[model samples]
Each structure stands twice: as C-alpha cells, then as structure tokens.
Target chain A: MTETEQRAGTRPIRVLIGKPGLDGHDRGAKIVARALRDAGMEVIYTGLHQTPEEIVEAALQEDVDVVGLSILSGAHLTLVPAVIDLLQAQNMGDVVVVVGGIIPEEDAEELKKLGVKAVFGPGTETDEIVRFTRASVGRA
Target chain B: MSLGQEILRGDRRALARALTLVESDPHAADDIIAEVYPHTGHGIVVGVTGAPGVGKSTLVDRLAGQFLARGRKVGILAVDPSSPFTGGALLGDRVRMEGRGSDVFMRSLATRGHLGGLARATPRAIQLLQAFGKDLILLETVGAGQSEVDIMGFADTTIVVVVPGLGDDVQAFKAGILEIGDIFVVNKSDRPGADQTMRELRQMLHLGPQRTWLPPVLSAQAQQEIGVAEIADAILRHSEVRLTDPEQRQRRMQEAERLVRDALADQLVRGVVSRSQADGRWNEVLAEVAERRLDPAGAARALHLEQD
Candidate 1:
C-alpha cells in the first residue's frame, strides 16, 4: 500500500501559493509549491499575474489552512495588505498568511505588523518554510 | 445558525467550511450532511475524465463559462492525485480556469491515494454544493485510467475527454472507460490525426450494447473554446434523456444500494479491526500468521468468528 493509503480516513493540510501583481517570474513560487507538496501538503498554485482580489477569492473558495504569497514584484507593501484586508473583510482572518520572495528586512517587520504570519526572503530554505507553515497551521 | 442552515441560506464561507469539514473530518460532517440531505438532488452533477494532458480542466473551464452565461450558479470540484510517498498534491487546475467568478465556486481535491480518479469526499462535496443551491456541479477527475470508473455512480452526465495520438481504435475497446462515458470528447482536435481519433471513438461507442442514450463522440479544441458549446448541448441532451427515461430511477436506486453496501462493508471492516487491535487479538493473529502457525485465510476467518 502507498503511504497515503496507510493513513487513509484522514485529510492532509491544504495551502494556496499565489503570485500577485504583474510578476511573471514564478520559478521561486513553483519551487516552494513543489516543496510543500513533497512535504505532504496539498498546494493550490494560482499562477502569475493575479490581482489581490483574485488571490483572496481563491483562498476563501479553497478554504485553505494557509495562504503562501510569493511576491517578487517589490509591491509587497501595497499588494500584501490588500490581500490581507480582503481576506479579513471576507471573514477569513483565521487563515494563516505567509510571504516569500525578495523583501527587505524592515518591510518584513512591517508586514508582520500588518498580520502577515511570516516573511520568507531570498535564500530561505524550503524546509524551513515548510516547517514554519506546518506550525502556523497547527499541523506540526 | 447551524452550519447546515448557513449553507442552505447561501453563506459562501459557511459552505466552504462545511466542504473542508467534509474532506478533513467526515465523521463531523455526517450531522451536517444529514441536515442538508433532503435539499440535495436538485443540482445537476457532471463528471469530466480523461488521461493526463487531455485538457479535462480546460474543457471544464469552458463548460463552466457556458453554464454561467446561461445564468446558472456553478460549483467545480477538481480532483488531482496525491503523491504516493508523501500524500501531498499540487492541484493546479485553477491555473487554467479563467471562468470562475463571484457566482462560481471552485475547490481542488487530492485523491489522497484513493484510487478511481476521484477523492473519497467528492460525493459529499457535491451534496454540499447541491444544498448550497448551485444549479450545476462540475466534477473533474484526476487523469483517469482505464478502470477508474467510479465517477459513473455520482455524476448525472459523464464526459470522457481524449486527445489524438494517444492510441487508436483498439485502445477504446479497453472495457471500463468506454462503458462509463455518456459523452466522448476528442479535445485538441486541431492536432494531426483528429479525424481518425473521432472515427475510432464513434466506432468503439457503437460497439457497445445499444441503450436508451447513445453516447455522442464530439470534437473540440478546448483551449480556444471551439466545439465547447456543442459539448454543452450534448450534456443538456443527455440530461434531458436521463430525466425522462423510465429506467433512470431504477439505475439511481441500484447505485444507491451499491453505495450503501460498500459503506457498510467498509465500516464493518474498520470496526472489527479496531476492536481486535484494542484487545490485542489483531497483533496476536498477525504474529501467528507471520510464524506460519495460521494461514491468512484462517486468521481472517478467526477474526470474523471473533466478531460474533
């Protein structure tokens, strides 16, 4: 029997990894998505160029345990807050939100102040991100 | 308000949570489903299946758009396979879907190592959508193989998509898939050998025993939305026949009976195994079987006898 079949009758954690704005570089996003999937989390990848509204809409509809935003467009301040606001406004304040991609240290702190769960900058280990996500969603 | 009541009242978040509960904690979902069961059977459920890269998701996207244009509230359940090693899944169907809007509800499901090209909770998810007042529910299966025919039990209409150059007419003779399709679509028909593919599908479909509904073999380039309207029309036609056909009631009842029997068998096995394990009899029997003191059949019989 497969590993999953051995644990039949249980559900795995679900995550949505999305890239918002006009950023077309999805290599980082795809890498993280694969890492999460390999770690046993179902990851919904909403490819590039998504608006904040679209990201939150997908998060709500999918009812994911975590929303991992991979933003490299340098628009994290505007887009991240927009997504968080939409999510909270839509009554999804409990969904854990994480950010990845290129972000300065100061902005990362700023995002945490805005309720972003964690910010993953360049050279961050995928395993570290995975572990952090699991703990954030209470699955670790 | 109760979650079931909220779902019935058309609260999107409530419905989403209920669906998550259905997938994650089915035991908890039982009460909710019982509460909403009477309101189900109102929505039309369509199942789309095919081999990998056959454009099942793309076609579903187009079909959802068609239904939306017709003013229908649509719910989509897209199933992908979970990794056998880690149980994780990359459900990327929404990437190809541009038709989802405020009125369209889409959720991705991992098969979670369950076979038959669908997640275990798919039927319950469909029930929830029906209770939420969706006019149509689209179920897109993980790339189906020849024997993944479970979708037949749940969907009102089943569309099997295929692309050319996969195989020839002999491939269609493979029993299970051909038997379950209510409609066959040759997606990516713009590619070479399209006519041959369609002709083979039509011929194979004809070879089946004649029934109330003759499954139509249609061609489509699903990416550009070509022939999608005709596919919608075919689904409508099939639905109409099913609604009016006298035998459909008997078919549905038979399906229900099968589902109940399967569930009962599952519960019986689980209950017996858990009880045996708790009492140490299961491990005792396992050791006996491992040492060759008792054969597997004898151990199984002993377990069953112990249950009494």
Candidate 2:
C-alpha cells in the first residue's frame, strides 16, 4: 500500500464516489477516484446519473468510510440533502459526506450545515481532496 | 439487539457492518459468525470466473435477475484485483451491472494481496450473506487466468465463463479451468467465432473423463440478455443434482477438508508468530536469516512448532 493508505487495524479505507442526480459530467469524480486509488484506498466508483437512493443504498451495502458526491448539474441543493437524509435515516450519520463539482460558496456552506464534511469546487486539486478524504475518515 | 441478532432479523445495515468486521477484525467477526452459523448453509453460492473482459460480471447480473424472478433473495460479491505495488484497487464491476432492486445486495471486494482470484475474507462475507438469509449468492472472482481454482472450494456451482476467439479447444485445458467447471458459458456468443468456440469447448469436454453430470457448454450474449435463462436453468439443475450425487458429495468432503486444513494452518502460524514476536525471537530470527547467518528453513525450525 502507499504510505498514505494506512489501515486503522487492517483493510484499506473504503470510499464510495457517487454521482447523484442528472449530473452527466463525471471527469472530476473519476479523477478524484483515481487519486484515492493511487493513495492506496479502495474506491468504489458508482457511475453517472445515480439517484440519491441508489447512492445511499450503495453506501449502506459497501459500509464505506466516506461518500464523495459529485454534482455538476446545479442540483446539489436537492440531490446532496436527499443523500444526507437517507444516510442519516439509516443511522449512517458517521459516514463522512463530501460534495464536489460546481457547488458555489453559499451552497457549500448550506451543505456543510446539513452535515457535509467538506466541499471542493471546480479547479480544486485532486491532491487536496485526497488529503482531506484521508483526514476526514476514521480509518486513516 | 446483538449484531448477529440484527443480521438474522433481516437488517441490511447490520449485514453490511458484519461484512466490514469480517475484513477488519477477525476475532470479533468470529464471535458474531459463531452466533449465526446455524442460520447459514441455506444460500447457494454460484461462482462466476473467467479471464479479463470475458463478461463474468454481466453474466452474473443476468443470472441474479433470473434467480430473483424465481422468488429467491439474491446477493452478489464481485472481486477485483488490488495493485500489488500500492495495495489500492479500483472496483468497477458494479458499473457493468444494472440495478437489481434493493433486495439484491451487491458488494465490491478488493483482493488485498490475497492470491487465487479472491479476497481472504470472501468466505466470511458469503457466510454473512447466508446468515442474513439470502437464498442465492453469486461470487464473481477477479479476472482469473490459469490455476485460480480456489473458487471450487467455496462455490456450490462453479460457472467458468469464456469468450470466443481467444484460442483453440486446448486453451481451457491448458488453463486447468476445464476440470473445475460445473458448467461452461461461452458468453458474447453473438460474435463471429461463437459457434467454433462452443464446438471446441464441447469437443474438449468429451475428451475428458466422464462424470455423473457432464459439464454443459452453453452459449449466451449476457449484454443483450439472450441465452442467459438457459445458463441459469443449467445452474439450477446442477444445484439439484449436487444434493444426491456421490461425486458431488466427495467434492464437498474434499472442500471441507481443505477449509479445515487452511483454518488450522492459519491459527498455528498466527499463534506461533505472535508468541515469537512477544519474546523478541521473531525479529532475532528474521535478522539472522537476512544476514544469511541462518537459512530460512533453519529459522522456521528455530520457532519449534512442536513445543509452541
């Protein structure tokens, strides 16, 4: 494993990178997934146009330490909260939720209020996201 | 309720948690599994294995749908390889599978440095699924090449998937997959060389020793959902035959023997290694071996397994 992918006891940190809602653009999500994998994390990339229910179900099934939602379709206000609520309703509030893709400062703040751990807008370096992911999850 | 109780009550989240525990904390997992062991042995595990790009995942997805339609609760465990260098893995098998509704639980596993085309925790995960009361469990192994036959020990029905145009009839024999498969699927059979591939596979099967149930070489275009039902039927027939067939009983005995041996081996090594480390003998012996003052076998002998 890479130096960054330290295990809490055993098994690498598992992350679910999901694209919720009608966001067709997935380049950012793919790049972040690749960066996480290179850092020795197991990344489960749920391909594009996933519903919030689908994303949360995947999180529950995967038991991922983190859920990174990428939304470029300006539906973060709707899709992000839906995912957060489903996770929380399932007693998965400890699963760190992060938002990426085209989210504005104000909306990002609003999402953080809704329990998103962090937000990365466009042009945020994948390394920054990777470091933040490593820091946010208990496994790391 | 206890974790095992929750799992037996049909809680999906608890099943997920127990599966994670299987990978991260074996001691705790052992306790939970002991509680639920009696609830298991009901799930039929089907192992789908093939070389890379041979449509194993899609075929599994299709077969799961078939079983689900037949009113069976389905679970899927798809394994991909981890990077030997970094230990990281990008698990993409789920992408190939369309959503199979909520009752069909799917999990992606990375073979974290384990060999034989599966993760070390796979059997444990399968047990968790079984305890959660899934009627069918489909195991998709890492794109297996030659000699990754460990699936035979874990699967009730082993389906060896292949595509056309790879090689002649001898290819399957060379890979040693010919012997382990209970049923063979020539997936993506819409391609030009599908007929020749199926013919070659049948020819090879006939050349081998006969059994109570001859492994059927079937055809399928898993992507389009064509011919998948036939393969599913074949799987069901094999599962039925596996119950009373003397040959299958012998195979099951062999599998149980291997599982026992593997568990004993793991426990012995872990016990001795941990004791040696606590007494500082492990590091000393390793250092000696590294410096070539003591050979590797001699170092192992120094551990004195008989006394430990």
- Per-prediction interface RMSD in Å: 2.4, 2.7
DockQ of predicted model 1: 0.65
| Tens digits of per-residue lDDT for model 2, B1-308 | 89999999999999999988887656668888889988887758999998899999899988888888999999999999898877788998877877764779998988887899998888889989998889799999999767789898899999999898876546655647988899999888888898988888888888889888899999999999999899889988998998877676687678778867977887787677778877888888888999999999988888866345
Kindly list the per-residue Cα lDDT of model 2 for residues A1-140, writing each as its tens digit: 21322342477888999998875888888999999999889999989878899899999999999999999999899999999999989999999999988988899999999999999998898888878988887555
Tell me the number of clashing residue pairs for each predicted model. Answer: 0, 0
What are the candidates' individual DockQ scores?
Answer: 0.65, 0.59
Report how far residue B184 has shifted in candidate 1, in Å: 1.1
Off by over 4 Å in 2: A1-9, B167-169, B305-308
Location of the lowest summed lDDT over 10 successive residues in candidate 2 chain B = B167-176
Evaluate chain B of model 1: give its TM-score.
0.94
Instruction: Please provide, for model 1 over A1-140, each residue's C-alpha lDDT reduced to its tens digit, 9 standing for 90 to 100.
Output: 22333466566788999989988999999999999999988999998888888888899888998999988889999999999999999989999999998999999999999999999998999999999988888873
